[model samples]
Target chain A: MVNTRNMVADNYTPESVAEAVRKYDGVRRKQAIGSLVRSLHIDNIDVVASYGEDAAVIQNGRTALLLAADGIWNKLMEVDPYWAGYCAILVNVHDIAAMGGRPVAMVDVLSASDDAIMTEVSRGMHDAAVAFDVPVVGGHLHPDAPYNVIDVSILGVAELENIIYSSKAQPNDAIIAAIDLKGRIHPSAPMNWDSVTMKTSDVLRSQISVMKDLGERHLLTAGKDISNPGVIGTLGMLIESSGVGAVVDLTAIPRPDLDALGITFEQWVRMYPGMGFIMTANRSDVETVCKKFRKTGMAAQVIGTVTSTKKFTLVKGEQETVLFNFCEEGITNI
Target chain B: MVNTRNMVADNYTPESVAEAVRKYDGVRRKQAIGSLVRSLHIDNIDVVASYGEDAAVIQNGRTALLLAADGIWNKLMEVDPYWAGYCAILVNVHDIAAMGGRPVAMVDVLSASDDAIMTEVSRGMHDAAVAFDVPVVGGHLHPDAPYNVIDVSILGVAELENIIYSSKAQPNDAIIAAIDLKGRIHPSAPMNWDSVTMKTSDVLRSQISVMKDLGERHLLTAGKDISNPGVIGTLGMLIESSGVGAVVDLTAIPRPDLDALGITFEQWVRMYPGMGFIMTANRSDVETVCKKFRKTGMAAQVIGTVTSTKKFTLVKGEQETVLFNFCEEGITNI
Candidate 1:
């Protein structure tokens, strides 16, 4: 693997990166999920798992049914309705992919202030649905609503034994970051890394199926898709869900040429990649898992190691800074 | 069956009821769906049926996965956040039930303006989920959105051969309206008929399972839950989807004591019932289907007959008026 440590800008430090991620809106918004979980929780015999996971796993006879929902941020809807709509479907598909399931179909609920906004949002959703090969089956539309919002929910299926869960990571496991790094930062949404949009359906499907292959092979202990919280924050969530912590060498994270792209390492770690995953696997199987992802044209490498301590720490050469202490304050507060 | 034809208020007319329903906001809001459907449509091999159905049927091996979504109206959220949240889950559960599927779990996307609204919405969602016996598996929450909106999606399972579809109504079938007339008008939201809230879980489950039982027995030709568009408007949608039409007798509708409840017949027909369904079945099996619903405490009646006329008409004794001519204008425009 190429060592990106020397290419890091001299101006950056571990403390700055930690502080920036902890204070970021993407990470901060996750705190609300804890209380919402408490309010919405209900017990059912069929649910194998629910809250705090990428997708809830429900036992449907011999199959594990995966269900997940995601809503685009209102800010995204206002700035670019088309991108917002596209991201809504993209995120839900990733939720299932993160769980090592085959996404079957999606349903959407769209509320728009006017017809123009609705049309643009639909166009974006249609394009993404076709690209993902997941049909937008049926949904509700509020045509004359006072505000615009797009929310998509997906259903997926997987074998019960092969399902990957977020809360199953063990201490001493290798933390790997796999990202498709061959695309530019989205112009419409700067915080978005537009990798998947330019890729063909075959490439996208192959990348998504890597997680499933790993699950079937029992290569992953835990996995989660890197989302709006970015790579580090997403890793924070995965460790938090597993009731564990991790220590990362910041420079080991795979990325395109940061110097040529004119983006600092700090900003790059916080941008939501179009296709990315942070996973945990046994040290012995780490090479095989990374190779599978690499075969799909994604850059994969071991970025961190799961730790027994309940504190997430970032290390940059000699400097080390703690980001989140799960024993005190959690990321999603789960 | 009780015939209350003479109990109809003297001031009502086929022309007036038809006009009021044709102009109703609940029906008008659905007109935007046709264009939205055209925009979101995508073909997938696994999808058995989608779009114009109550729940999309996705074939997963031997199981048919039912997927559907609903967003609570902003007006409901503003008037009463609790009801809005409750209805979000309620509508999704109904969507699956209307398709004769056993709802497994649900996920939601909620955007609240403040913590208080979120808490209230959560309470409502929690109560309804418990009442219906379906767990809220997982969801996304926007804690700081400018507007409050609650959208929920459900996953259910059914035998592929036993799945009921809204687009399968045969011409000349009996149109059945099954509703629990034991409910009073909701105080906070006048347009809502509160029925299931006070019922026990056993009663609620029994009411929901009636449709599934009908489907398994192949007793219904087509079915859809009566939602915000009320009875006639919902039937208009079913006929519109099936590419058929219907003629209804106004006095045959099942309703509570309107005079005692201080409401008019026209208003009662437009009120959204807490537990209701509109179905089409063969003329010979209509009595058996109505009896099944009645055993579960709902008032089931043959309110209309499906026709190939491509026009929806309402008749009062000797007078008849066309509410919607599917050949010209359509409700839901689908």
Candidate 2:
């Protein structure tokens, strides 16, 4: 393997990375999410929490039912139908996993204009479902639709007390980011890293279970799976939700060889790694939690610290830059 | 109020009704549904039934969790976003209700190209949510989408033993169609018969409860709510699912004043009457079931009889036309 240590040392620039993340489409698309939540929200008996969280929690007697839905962007669908279908299930599963819940089943609503596209999309969905051991139970199909769109919603169950939320991070905690950097960028979709698709099911499941273990043991105060917004942007969202701030050290983030991947340091911070998460843990529990992710074949590093000030800052050696100020300009406005 | 008896006597024409139902857009859109189902289907453990059924059933413990998603057509959304949103929730609730299930909660994925459209859609969704008493728990939003769309999926629960299925109808059964004809066509949406919106909550709840009562009492063998395909087309689907046939006497179908509404006989049969269902039951149980619907402020009529041969026929006096033959041309091919 090419040495990543030197590349990490050479690219420790604060301004470049912040600018790339600020302009990333993955991060920009989320600006309207908060306003949409405000418009659609309604008071009800069963709902515990709706928007501003990974999964909506519904009270179901002794257990809490987690409900969440995600749609693939049209741009992605145009580039790769299979990846679009796979991501539809992948992102929804992560939504449940991020909330400290066990994914039970999923249903999909697919609207495609042609048969060839539908076959490829369903193949991707089926393969992912089998690999994750989660069934695609039932869904609606619009075969003669005018355009191609895939939307998936998942249901999961969790103990009411054991659930971890994005809005619960505490001050003075360590921000830990864990990611599998063994795979290359997907050929069909440049923004996606193809780590889980090539890896054995055993390895993928183990990586997913690490989050559950952390939640069960109460090791993480707040956590989120690294999604379309990439690692730093995801951490920014968690910090925003928790009403706190974070200071991240650019050199400490784990990454693969930048030269071999033919990508810049700024691009890496904005790309969606196939299997990754950003979490906040108490200073005392940080080491043990990082050790668990490392055991699952991921590079785990304590790259930042949670702060009391409502500003997200990026630090590279002596240089520092403000990434987000939650008090002024919000990410999701949640 | 007009004399119902005189109106019914002057407007009944089986040949005209058959032609109208055959050409209705609600009935025409369903022709493509079966081909789509055939393409997307895959083997899974939890999925009990899909496609031609009202709601897809997933096995969950001793009970079954009914899951379904529905999206309003673009034409409807352009004309009335509020009605589009209302129908999105209305259709999902009906899917579960048709299956003898109790709806628990729902999640929506909404995309709007403009603010006025988004506000109207949300207003309609909020009103229907309160009317049905099923909360909109959580969902995703695409605030800057190029096109407008509203897709909703619901979760419901039913006892495995009491869950009604569309494939359980038997030969020699009486076909019972129940509809609330106490309202006029919606001015904004001509195809939509505005029944439940004008009724009191008590009346609306009772109308929905009639299906659950039928399932619990084992009064109906197979059933489905009248959807875009209207009354006759909905019955055609039920017959197809049951692997049987049906024959209806045009004189027996209940309808409002066709002359006053300025709609032809064919249009009335094909129009999507809000809060309508077509069910099959033994001759002995027909009267009792009709009484239950009538008590809920609906008009119930024994319109047809189930047959062993797979053919759907409509007769008015001596004139008859074959609408569908499951052995030859199936509606949904369930």
Candidate 3:
């Protein structure tokens, strides 16, 4: 059991935690992004942000157009193509939702080694798309590939003034961890937290729309959808993009019943929860933002304080450990 | 060598030619799309066109937003990741161009087994993106995959009134085949014709712009950028979408000296030329449309005529071959 009050949480050392997170496949896979980003330059004046955000924003008159692409992990596809297909839609929709945008449609490119498995993937994608109310308008399919892969790209639109940016975190803002705790670990993939599959379309739509509502009311200074890197690593990306840091109180981070779930706190932190977001809110708006998230049944708490210093530290009891030294290294390096 | 003015073109029977094209890997690979399309419901009223077109067009106020995705062949990626990378961008850009829209940005999802080859692929994508003037805005990377795969998606914008649709070919429209003949077969992959990599950006831009120009002028009734299905197969898709048929004179189709290239006429028809388009224009506009393409250094010809029958046929001398009986089986089944 995790020691509820101690900062170290258990006998885990700061170095061990840091190494575990750093060496995680989710975090390490991001290392290749920095180089590809440097090579793919943004020359279009309409492009407001790219590479560092969950979705790229393009200026279109008074509206902002959002675009993003995501691919399934090969192992995940092999283990469960149905889940792979569903996540392809889920992740892309969240990319837009993280930007406080209205996801409209998606296009997918699926490469498969066989037909039956591809059908399973397609079925999962279809069910997700309908649940999210976003159309998979069109895409490409490579039927006879040696390996199976599913990639999806999404399009969204948002009011220019209401678009939430990941690079706008301020020094005095409070970092909030908002997660839906009413789900079990995916039976097939322990790393995945399953919450959306069992939820009604109405509930899921309302949950995703809360971000837009927050953006409209200017409740958060910065925000990002929690992805494969989990809450801590995702926060590192946000802070790196914002050029700031945070000292998180470990006990304040939200979680389900870990004992019942049969997962350690470290393992839970690394899971890709079905519905989660990390956000930084102005000190005056932290209570209101947390209240809004709580309205949607999400466990929201002010878990940390943003700082001017470029080091991310986790504090538990009297002991403190630095998770990322942005001045020296970064999760994505971009 | 192919004998000119022969009824059978190369002593090949019409049935054999039809079977060869129908069974081509490029055309057969698209077989999985119809079922996927049926599963993905397009309920959004803004979706103007989806499964059948090169790009999905969504209505956005006075403008149209175009979205499209394409993945490279797996064997090609393994043989040459660099060309695979370039073609990823090339094909996505062409998707927008085929819709008569100006491509604004791109997002890619690249899965690789190693860093060195990924770096090479990234370099190739970067070079092609820079040459095409479309920035790679944002995307995902799967670094440690068992195989290499590159998927790219494009976002484009066009005037709502001027958007050219693939399903608009008139009964008597002339089918125009515009291809750049100044380049040789790709050394890395014989199936691909290398034209864009060797041409200057000015020429490539001009060639791509011709479709938009034709759209604005209302010269083309329908259009599609030639893709993996090759010229004849691609034209079949256009005609099928329009619910019409075409009789193409094989001898009049544009070519790049197949004898010198040491390829048969059938192989030439199946090659995926880098810079080519199949468009349907009014009989009176054919001269102007062909002239416009010629100005961009492309070989343009009116080698076919659209008909009301739901069958795509090929003609050589006095012999005629039914390439596709679309009434019975359409290419994409969309």
Winning model by lDDT: 1
TM-score of 1: 0.97
lDDT by residue for model 3 (A1-334), tens: 6565453334454455666777788877887788778877758889999889999999988889899999988878988999999999999999999999999899999998898888999999999999999999988999888988999999999998998999999998999999999988987788999988989998889888889999888888999999999888888889989999998887688988776576767777778988999999988998898888788888999999999999999876677889889899887888
Query: For model 1, how does the per-residue alpha-carbon lDDT over A189-240 read when each residue is reduced to its tens digit?
Result: 8789999878898999999999989989999999999999999999999899
Each candidate's DockQ score against the native complex? 0.90, 0.50, 0.81
Assess each prediction's global lDDT (C-alpha) against the native: 0.91, 0.83, 0.88
Candidate 3: tens digits of C-alpha lDDT, residues B249-292: 88788987666677777877888999999999889999999999
Clashing pairs in 2: B26-B228
Q: Which candidate would rank higher by TM-score, 1 or 2?
A: 1
Give the TM-score (0 to 1) of chain B in model 3.
0.96
The positional error of residue B56 in candidate 2, measured at the CA in angstroms, is 2.4
Please give, as one word, the docking class of candidate 1. high
Q: Estimate each model's TM-score.
A: 0.97, 0.92, 0.97
Q: lDDT per residue, candidate 2, A155-227, as tens digits?
A: 8778777787888888899999999998989898788887788888788778887887788899999888898
- Model 3 is docked with a DockQ of 0.81
